[model samples]
Target: MEISARNSIKGTVKKIVHGSVNTEIILEVASGVELVSIITKSSAENLGLVEGKQAYAVIKSSDVMLAVE
Candidate 1:
């Protein structure tokens, strides 16, 4: 909520793919524009990420992270 990173895109969770170690999440930022973020499986679950849920795609330097409230 109060951080330093400036590159943040609000979008809805579009898709999710689970792997053994990581999970792939796709966020639809715009009509056809989407951002994909790969995070740890436990992290994804901890965030309660699900399709149609609102989330933020935080981009800092070369890393893309996901955040929720």
Candidate 2:
């Protein structure tokens, strides 16, 4: 499929947290680096996102923020 997003990182599904409205997906892109994305439950189900599955984090954004504690 064709997509407009330029950032596409391949990763494995580490964990999935299902909420009442949305689902939190944690993807391990590298040995220590990980990315988290929150998507609708229906969308997640449609994509068949589960642990140990391979997926891509398709990022289509203009800005990304970083924080420090």
Candidate 3:
């Protein structure tokens, strides 16, 4: 897929959490680092997203948010 996001990281899907409306895909990148992507169930199914499958996490700098506790 052609994503406009420049900060793209390739990783494997490590886990999938299906919610009532949306699904959360967890991807494991380098050592102990994980990236999360949220998508609709239909979209996830359409993309055939599954654990252990190769996928790309497209992240844009503008989309990132910072928080402190």
Q: What value does the lDDT take at residue 10 in candidate 1?
A: 96
Residues 1-69 of candidate 1 have per-residue lDDT tens digits of 866888899999999999999999999999999999999999999999999999999888966589999
Q: Could you tell me the lDDT of residue 53 within candidate 1?
A: 99
Clashing pairs in 2: none
Candidate 3, which segments miss by more than 4 Å at Cα? 61-63, 67-69
- 61, model 2: CA deviation in Å? 1.2
Cα deviation in Å at residue 56, candidate 2? 0.4
Q: What clash pairs does model 3 have?
A: none
lDDT of each: 0.96, 0.96, 0.91
Better of 2 and 3 by TM-score: 2
The C-alpha TM-scores of every prediction are 0.87, 0.89, 0.82
Ordered list by TM-score, greatest first:
2, 1, 3
* Model 2: residues with Cα > 4 Å off, grouped in runs: 66-69
* Clashing residue pairs found in predicted model 1: none
lDDT by residue for model 3 over 1-69, one digit each (tens)? 787777889999999999988999999997799998899999999999999999998877755578999
Minimum summed lDDT over a 10-residue window in model 3 is located at: 57-66
